[model samples]
Target chain A: MEILLSLFNGILIALEPINLGLAVIGVVVGLFVGAMPGLGSVNGVAILLPFTFVIQSFTGGATSPMIFLAAIYYGAMYGGAISSITLGIPGASTAVATTFDGRPLAMKGMAHVALVAAALASFIGGTVSNVLFTAFAPLLASVALSFGNPEIFALMLLAFATFVGLGGDDIPKTLFSICFGLVLATVGFDIISGEPRLIFFDITGFSHGIRFLVLAIGVYGIGEMIWTINTSRYGSSMSKVDVSWASMIDAMKRFQEAWRGTLIGSLLGFFVGILPAAGATPGSLMSYGVTKMLSKNPKEYGKGAIDGVAAPEAANNSASTGAMLPMMTLGIPGSPTTAVLLAGMVIWGLQPGPLLFTNQPDFVWPLIGSFYVSNLVAVLVNLAFIPVFLWMLRMPFTILAPLIFVLSLVGTYAAYMDMFDVWLMVFVGVGAFFLRILDYPVAPAVLAIVLGPIAEPKLRQSLLLSDGDFSIFFTRPIAGPITVIAIILILLPLFKVIYDKIKGKPAEA
Target chain B: MRRAEIVTAVLLGFFSVYLMWKSGEPPAWDPDVPRFANIGMIDGEGPGSGFWPFWLSAIMLVSCVWIGINWYRKKSPPSVSEEPFLDSYGKRTLFFVGMGLLGFLILIHIIGFYGGILVFMIYYMRFLGRHGWGITSLVSVSLVVFSFFFFDIAMRIVLPKGYLEPLFIPLYDMFL
Candidate 1:
């Protein structure tokens, strides 16, 4: 098939020593970022985008852009495990359940095992997903070409409903939070009108733009710092973080046991990644859940189970790959990182849509192929850094706090030259702090924000195209089935909750 | 969770009512304005382009209220009123957040965005993390300097330089 040949060509381009080097660097950085508590994937990638701008300017090639974008994502994957194993915190929502088992293992002096499993699982997921993307992306893109605006709108709605309903806490609050994000998105420019909607009386940076980085860093980074300072039991902090070759050997043994978990994770992640709203969080959560349900030693789950580590890590990586499906095919971003990638594409004068495959196979294939190289690089770097990363946690907070604080600020400022970013960070932090008190899940809020504005336009476009026929949603077979699926997703949680209550069982995690 | 839900419900209700006012009041007679052609005329005529978002938001608002009412009537124990607000964990988080906010407010004016961020990171890393001076300094300098060159100079984007303008110019020349 020409598609297959093109894909092979992409591999050739992606495997270029320079591109390969960048891919490796991305995975290495992704691991470090993923390991850090609070930095997580989204903020980690966002913080790194400034560097990408520089890369793009100097090289003026698609390779540099792909390297920057892919690296941030890979770094985020690496970052996710750090907090999970060491601090009992899943750096991102997707990895939340990882802490249940990972932290316990670390406490039991198996941090190295947890780290190794995470890395291996992530590597497997990333590599497998890249293969899947290469094999299936074109076929999927062809199918996507026929999708009308109504289908797109329905998909967005499905994503919104599923996230709002299934995300950790109270649905109403989540919707409200999402609405808040939509409001923020609408602040500067009116997409169709090209007129300012909410830009108030002239401020210095107001005319140029309001970068989302400012908001994300302010909320998650600075706000998180404040929240951490307020809540941390430094008195209750980990007593020890020891790394050993023996522990790593044990981790390898655990990985051997969790081969099924890695496979399941990668498969589920791939499927979820292909879907519009199913991102790393759901991918990780679902993989972890399925692994637990199917495990022979179910009791070991949530109690330092090695498979627990593998499932979520794999799920996260695979789902990240999955998130790219829509971006590549439909020009719709399912996740924030992908949204940033979309932004990068726009900046490069390349629009992401059905035409991407035909118009710029040169650009597209290499990026997809590079994912494989990136995943391999991630594994190598993560393995090397295992002991080093583990040991770094033992360093006293006196030295760690200031450095992270500075990195947070510098990272924020680097995204854009505005001090407004710092302020935005504080605002988000304050809001996040309060929401934490209320058990309001930030992920849904974020998901809502990211997807809301996008869906709104699609809905309108669909309506316009259909001459206001709402039936198009149900009439078009592809759109109709997807809508039905969305409906099921919305109702599934309600039914599960009600059934649990009737059965005298507590809510499912 | 219940009381918070109640408040959210009320707010949604209010927002919906507000949207009703906002949606119908878009400046009229613009040729560019789009409208839905058919919808059985919810009121007077078929809904306009803004109709779906506004009405859907309104429906959401109503649903939130219903959810709030159900929780209030059910007397859910997990409600905000039942739980201690700002638990110990919450308090600790607030302090660091305060430090960040205070630092930004004060330093951005005095040191400029780049300097303030660099200083903020160094202070946080050293004070809060208790990292070594070497790691702290190296990370702070590299991140700040590299980002400055990348975003400001190379990108031709301007950063806010309160008192650090003089320093930034020399750096800009070297990179750009």
Candidate 2:
């Protein structure tokens, strides 16, 4: 009852004119920033952090400024899906899984369904996570604290195993792709020993390593565009992007088709987000893999499954909200954006952790109140802007194609301020095109690179603690069960083969 | 398609082997530590710097060989198919697009992003796309102007201006 009263009063304070107006502006700014390649919520909030001081000086409390930043964080989660669906290039790392099915939906002229599913799922995910946050903030933060190195590595292995077990792609090719990406990620200096490794031809650029955006934009933005043009010969399926309002209305009514994915993502993403360093990316990805593994028609995934688009979209938004749990209650940032938000709190002279709620109910409730408010505004703004987004898809293939190429190049350069990366991006794009033609699944490779840097260190640290014993993964309380599951997932195909042989049906795929 | 599959496998296999060799090399600062020393655990440290990449590359090499065996047995679809890897039309399209991109990169180094963007857009719209010069000029010119304002002035990204640096000086004097 006390929680209810605090929340209700918090909602009233959040609805104040200054706070309400700031929410609108922040959401708009965040939406654009998140939808742009090489920019995400972190960049948006970091760049605009200075502006919040001005807001603070006027409002004379940290609540207004904090509300504005939180609104931007919420809005950016919605916007990340925009580029993932329409352009096939993820606007942020968090939305990477969306491209697996979202791009195919766009190609099939059902972009409305993908876009609508993404937006509605995001709204549901955000709201579900908010309720979970309001109910279990302290409990979840304590739970998050217990996740150590071995557990995190086990989770990472589970993510990769899902792709191998449930992914309908060729086995050797998928394994190869995964290995190649992991190796590529190790090109820069070794984090533990501070030793440079695999500096290809000793180019100075190799010292910084291969950046994620370089590879992502290369494969999706440039390679996919070129492949689309080659396959369609310009009169292709992508050119037939549907822009009718009827589809939009129909999409709203038919969103229930993706109910399973939405539910899985909402629940899973919130839990995953509460764990520090495991952010929205892995949450969305794990949700994608889990939804696919459980689906009766697993083949529908990566071929325009509405559930595929919905799952990741929902997960990213849900996880963004869940990420705040640790920040508010434990004084620990669950994700990079939350890290920035923590900094903002520190500057505001507010002490985070268990006492914040007791000492500063005025700040706590209003901030929680703003999460609900910002999520509502974000969905409404996204829905209203649907027509404008669809109009860009109506462009001619030749025009759109060059624009994508230019953006891929310019965005890469802008990201690291390195011309070498721009050239490497083009090279990777050409390589991706060849790999795509040969039916090599590049998605696993993309996933591997994203997780590799994080995975390697956890593995080493765990081994170190256990005196080089591999059993550390299988012996720990939390890590044991997760590790066993991952091993089962990896060996699922071999089990199938053995079963098939016993059944006298040992046929080649 | 069949032959291209084998060739690609062979090339990738070679690349993987090269990576394995490079991974085992000692850090430049401590060359006397011996090659492949970093491929496993050091005495005091956990795993060496080369542990992850060296093992991963070995797996990649094994996968490539598996691909080769599949190709030899005519098991993979690409191995069995009679279709050319890229037909005449695909070849022509690839050559033109590839050359255009190469030219754009060169132009970026020579004339910077703004000037490079202008030329590339005009070439793409007018020549490759077969649009009218009037429309191409209008669209391309408008894009350059919008980019200058958005990336340079408003965001303060300061994209290189190349030979056009002198031309933008007065504008920078006015704005920046």
Per-candidate clash tally: 53, 0
Candidate 1, residues A381-430: lDDT per residue as tens digits? 87888877677556564444444455455555544445676566557767
Best by DockQ: 2
lDDT of each: 0.65, 0.87
TM-score of the A chain in candidate 1: the value is 0.67
Q: Write the per-residue lDDT of candidate 1 for residues B10-115, one digit (tens) a residue.
A: 7657866664444343333454644332112333323343454455555556656755655666533345356656665655645764665487668878987678
For model 1, how many clashes? 53
Q: Candidate 2 chain A: minimum summed lDDT over ten consecutive residues — where?
A: A163-172
Model 2 segments beyond 4 Å from truth?
A165-167, A506-509, B173-176
- Compared with the real two-chain complex, what DockQ does model 1 have? 0.25
